[model samples]
Target chain A: MTANARPILETERYRLRILTPADATPRYLGWLNDPQVTRYLESRHRPNGLDDIRAYITSHDGHAGFLLGIFTKTGEHVGNYSMRIDLPNAVGTLGVMIGDRDHWGRDVVLETRAAMLHYAFETLRLHKVCGACLSTNLPAIYNYRRQGWAHEGIRREQAIGDGGSRVDVVMFGMLARDWRQRREMEQEK
Target chain B: MSAAKEVLAQAFDVSITEVPDDAGMETFTPWDSLGHLKVIAAIEEKIGRDLNTEEVLAVIDLASIEKLIAGVHRV
Candidate 1:
């Protein structure tokens, strides 16, 4: 957590590090092009190429915020987590995609989210952290609700979904105090 | 499931043994929106307070309900 040092995070079973242009591989491109993997993500709106992925990764060089690669202990890259901050508001917006179908339903989301929340609140010391998902994504909606994130509101028919159907965007928010309270409660358990 | 079996079983109107380990929105057939709220209400009654968003979300299924009302199943 030292200043000016590269941030590399490790949980019990996963290691998360910033993704660079070199990290963009055909497999990563495959994920962006996979409808099943990107179903609930905004990325599904358009196709992506290797150059696009590289540029996206290059844009977040950790100057302010960066894209994190979610990796297994065995060095397999399964997904991506992006963090963007509004310094004036001291708020962060997180976007995630578990591209690897093999890792679905395996608690990777829960584990990685805990790590990112800690980094967001404890390390970054941000005032708030939030994420949004399409309303049609039942599993994500269920996760956000179960995680106790405040349902800020929903943007009705925010975007188009598969088959040209419109979908609402649901937002969830968590404040610094709320994070502390949740942690304290976890300790009491 | 010992802690909240009666509550879940009663809400779903089934025997306690009928509740499976993976009973959730996706797995449990009866766990629709109404059933979810029912479980939430029962958990609230057991805890003696209304569930906050976080607590409500934690009670996704039978095991979560047991965890929410911990110590009831341990004994």
Candidate 2:
């Protein structure tokens, strides 16, 4: 999709940009409000309104964290990639949300991770990027492995699912070295 | 019926031609969570046994599946 002048990262089919306060639209608020959309996200626990969205967007200035909007070539905001950086440790924890139902199962999250991981390791010079998902979120678990993150460990019975069942959190990590090797492997292929 | 790629292609409802040389769960569109479960069941049906959670998760790629099938046949 055609991107704005400043994109944090660009993939084959996505433009990742830091979201602005004005980018907080009613549709975005609806995604957070929709249980089907936010079921796996902690944000699902609370209802998010325009003001909250705007405030959160502004809070991230690309230094401490980024509220990046993933846009299609046609300029539709289908999802977001959120990265929270720990300056002292040089680690970033990332999460993805494909708000648009139409984009589900389309491998958007996979591409988003590839682009953002490059940014985190190369641009930001972060030492590592990590993410965790609920054990029951099988798609996410497979993505973490497919994306080349080491399955660091699991926090047993860490969280409760919507069904009121305890679910473990699977931790994943990728160091700068791992990212380099992955890129090298891609080049070799 | 005994080929790893064939089993995966069948489980994912795709043709063997579509699968990559270094085939893995990520490379295919239908190889998601549900597809993963189907792959496990398909493999079990071919091997004529059930797989444990560990064995199921270890089916990371086509090569791994091939190795698992070979090991089962050896036994």
What DockQ values do the models have? 0.10, 0.31
Q: Pull out the clashing pairs in model 1.
A: A148-B54
Ten residues in sequence with the least summed lDDT for candidate 1 chain B:
B50-59
Write candidate 2's Cα lDDT for B1-75 as tens digits. 238988887787788887777777867667875576678778888788875434554678888788778775242
Taking the tens digit of each residue's C-alpha lDDT, what string does model 1 give over A1-189?
A: 222225688998899998988889999999998889888888877769999998889877574576899999999999988988887777889888889888876667767888888888888878899999876665576656656678887777888888998877878998888978988998998
lDDT tens digits, residue span B22-50, model 1? 77655777765435656766777777876
Q: What is each model's TM-score for chain A?
A: 0.95, 0.93
Whole-model lDDT, candidate 2? Answer: 0.80
Model 1 error, position A94 (Å): 0.3
Q: Quick one: best lDDT, which candidate? A: 2
For all predicted structures, in order, the TM-scores are 0.74, 0.81
| Candidate 2, B-chain TM | 0.81
